[model samples]
Target: MARNPERRNALLDAAIEVLTDEGARGLTFRAVDARAGTPTGTASNYFADRDALLAQTATRVNERMVPDPEHVASLMAAEPSRELIVHLMRDLVRRMTAERSGYLAMLELRLEATRRPALREELNRTVREQYDGNLQFHLASGLPGDADAMRVLYLAMTGLLVEHFTLPEMLSDTPEALDELVAVTVERIFPAA
Candidate 1:
């Protein structure tokens, strides 16, 4: 891998755009180069293979989507109460809605991972790392839940986010209704205090 960090990031962003718009099958070095408006073969200069390109694209999408530590800490400042959890869920879903393209790219990566062992291994590792990190954060913050609770919360949030981003009206009539849905989901999963 050539280490042109700036150029590599530009290529990764372009890859995400391609994935978001055309799905995994459409993600090609030439597509990325064209999307980035760079010279032909520019993406190939940085990526050794399609697997490497997809791996970097996934990493970049994850980086773009994760919230900053400070914001997460502020959200947790009120302690791990039901209401606080609901607010966090709302914010998370809202953030996913805003970053719909990135989320779509991630979905594309996940679907493509099913057929590529190397990509599957890497994506699985990344997913486990995120799950572990969330569990650790919950424990450190004194959240009232264990691994199973976290799993349920994770699934619930994933479902909510997918619905919000893909089929918004199915979840609610308006944005306020979506907030209520988040509140209800959190309350159900976390148990009211």
Candidate 2:
């Protein structure tokens, strides 16, 4: 089948929404087709099987959540500094907060990866790609942190994102408070000399 980019992307987006609502086991070609409001067999036509659909969905979720590279660069100062790190966190929190559903679907993908080796490998590679990119950016920018610090920062930011999205009431009630949390988290991850 000749794939139209728009249609294929729409189906993948709908798949994310389905995964977000139904979890890993609930995602199916038929479900995606139904959610996308497309004719039956549409999702199957685009993807070879369940695994392919899932791998693609995970990739799409990551792609959708990335903040603009230039925006990140602008905030990350040439020297490793708390301001740069806090700025970076602010951008990430804003993006993930706005795309709560996609992030939730990504969490679902994590559960699904545990049982499927192929899916696990795909998700690992996707995550590593993002990690490597951040490391590279940090290196080039002379950011104050080693690879290990970056990993810690990533995990801390992820935890904050999960809580902020899942039980928002449990988190800071105001945007400023959340930003303060982000600043504190980043500061802890990479303490000043």
Candidate 3:
């Protein structure tokens, strides 16, 4: 039987919904099949196994979060603006908060990937892509181009985001707290300009 791309996408979408809504512990072939409105055997036929489904799901999540090559190139060509950087950071935080379950699912996948070499490799590749894209954006925005500086900025931004998700009060105490944090972080990282 021919594999339907539409069916595959439907399954993938359902997988994401299940993962986000129920976490990794709740994700199962049966649940996904039900969510996709497909036959019980269809998911297994398409995914072969849970690991395969997870790997594909991780790839999909990364693709959705990070900018693509063309988008990155365009960002690199544009003039660096603090407003743009802050907006990006704010949007990422908002998305993370809104998709809390999805973020938790990704964290679970990261833990599982530690014991699975193939999954680990796929995650590492995604991380590299994210780092590269972020580096390009930071550089284009006139931040220091040194790897160390970029790493520090990335780490700080990630830490802030984690806090934003886990401790919403820390950021939501005031309307401008997140913006202030971003501004401070940016100025500290790119002091010269």
Q: Pick the candidate with the highest TM-score.
A: 1
Per-residue accuracy of model 3 over 86-163 as CA lDDT, tens digit each: 556665666666666567667767777888888899889988887897777566567444777778778988788767
Instruction: Give candidate 1's root-mean-square deviation (CA, Å).
Output: 1.2
Expressed as tens digits, the lDDT of each residue in 1-193 for candidate 2 is 6479899899999999999898888899899999999999999999999999999999999989888778766665345676777887898888887898899999999989999899999999999998898789777777688888888888888889888887877978889999999998988888877
- Higher TM-score: candidate 1 or 3? 1
TM-score of 3: 0.78
TM-score of each: 0.95, 0.92, 0.78
Q: At residue 121, what lDDT does model 1 achieve?
A: 88
Alpha carbon lDDT at 31, candidate 1: 99
Native-to-model Cα distance after best TM-score fit, residue 71 in candidate 3, in Å: 7.5
Ranking by lDDT: 1, 2, 3
lDDT of 1 by residue, 137-178 (tens): 877787777778889999988888777777888978798999
> Model 3: which ten-residue window has the lowest total lDDT?
71-80
lDDT of 2 at 98: 84
Better of 2 and 3 by lDDT: 2
Q: Order the candidates by TM-score, highest first — what do you get?
A: 1, 2, 3
Better of 2 and 3 by TM-score: 2
